[model samples]
Target: MNTEKTSSQPAYEPGGCLTAVARGIALVVVVPVRLVWDALGYCLKHLWRWVLAPLARALGWLIEHLLLIPLRWLWEWLVVPVARALWWLVEHLLLIPLRWLWEWVLRPVARALWWVADLLVVTPIGWLWRHVFAPVGRVVGAALAWAWGIAGRISRAVGRALALVLWHAVGRPLAWAYRVVLTPVGHWLRTYVGRPVAEAARAVRAATREVWRALFGGPR
Candidate 1:
């Protein structure tokens, strides 16, 4: 009994040594990996949040508020006023003299020449027209009027005779036929055909409006 050992107890354990060795190796590998991961995370968070993000926001605000806004204000206030003044000086100084010369010198000379030509040529033509041509024109006009009056009277008499014959021969029968047959037919067609056509057209228009509104979502 003193020499026998319990079966649950091991005298020399080989697996226990192996487990201790495995735990030591895992701590050696995982400790460095975890330290590198934590260091990388800390660097990234502080770099962006403290340095890069603030610098970018400051640059954007400086450009928009200070540089771009002042440049626009300077252009509107200084450059625009100088440009308008230059244009005004050019128009008043250069164009005004040219306009005065054209109006005062050139226009008057052109008008004087026109008056001389009218006096020399047009006055004589007018005298001749009034004194010589007018009398002949009046006599010819009177003769033509007399001939036209005679022709017109003959034409009037012929037209009246033809009109009377037409009325007796054709017009009375046509009028009678229209009163007897065509008038009632026209009235019946207007009452039946026209009313139904108008109603159908109204219904078609209403349906078209409804379809148009359905498609386009608006009043027709």
Candidate 2:
């Protein structure tokens, strides 16, 4: 038999009540925070966009037009002219007499002293160097050259002897040892040890690839 069912209200949930209370509390808490945040944001935006920005622009304009412009003008008009005048006075008034004195008096005296020195000291020294020292220097230089040539010949002979001795004693033995011992050893190692290692490495790589493929179902 079919029973007639009455409509029943859903059961009240504590979670929904708690969620609504939490939402209300959150709204109460967040409203003031959002309001304060918005107020501060508005204040900062306006402060920067209107007040501080304009103030900064005005300060920049004032500095450029008032301070820097005036300083530049003063420098160009007053300081530059004064500096030019000072330079002109120093060049013409102060330096001209000194230059004239130096040209007329000091320069002439210096020239006369130079001529005397040439006549007395330099000319004699030059003559001695040309006539006396040059011949002695030539002799010494020739002797040195002869000695150097002899030394070079002796050195060449000694070097040749050393090279011959080394060839017989050291170089030939080293070459023979390398050819007989080291080359054979290196060849044996490359053939026996290196080949086996390479083969083993290849086998290991193939095995690893097979295992990886088995596990991952692909090469990657």
Candidate 3:
């Protein structure tokens, strides 16, 4: 029997000339950029570590010792005691006197003025309005209302009488004349005079049309 040997490995080929050229171009372009980036990183790291960090520390120390310390001492020693003394003086001299004046003098004076105004002006006006003006106004209003009622009754009676007089004197006569005399006259005229005149006018118009038709030809 004949047997054949089989292999599971894949084939490999060497790179071409174009592949080498491309690799060389990429290397030439990337080397200088990579070097520049690394150098900048190194420089920045050392600058921060040595120069910038020390400068920041020195500035922080100077501010704490020179400015903040002196200000703190001034606030604790000088400003605090001065402020306390001024507050004490204001409380004793100005505020206490003003409070006492307002409580004792101004308040009592205002109360007395209010009482005087109430007694002199407000009380008298209230009494006059309640006692004198109110009663007088009520009496006058009642008298006017009574007069108005009487006048209204008289006017209504007069109006009714006038209506009755007009009905008897004018309205009844006119209605009677219209119903009796004018109605018969109008009916007679419409039947006899108006009907005859209209019929005569129609006859005359027909005769005139016949004459015209005879003289001329028939209507064009």
> Each model's C-alpha lDDT?
0.94, 0.96, 0.95
Which tens-of-lDDT digit does each residue in 176-203 have in candidate 3? 9999999999999999999999999999
Q: Model 2 clash tally?
A: 0
Task: Give the TM-score comparing model 1 with the true structure, all chains together.
Answer: 0.32
Give per-residue CA lDDT, model 1, range 71-91, as digits (tens).
999999999999999989988
Clashing pairs in 2: none
Q: Write down the worst ten-residue block by lDDT for model 3.
A: 1-10
Question: Against the true structure, what is each candidate's TM-score?
Answer: 0.32, 0.39, 0.62
User: What lDDT does model 1 reach?
Assistant: 0.94
- Give per-residue lDDT, candidate 3, residue 123: 98
Residue pairs clashing in model 3 are none
Show where candidate 2 strays beyond 4 Å. 1-31, 57-66, 95-105, 122-220
User: Can you tell me which runs of candidate 3 are displaced by over 4 Å?
Assistant: 1-45, 65-101
| Candidate 1 residue spans exceeding 4 A from truth | 1-68, 76-78, 143-220
TM-score of model 2 (CA atoms)? 0.39
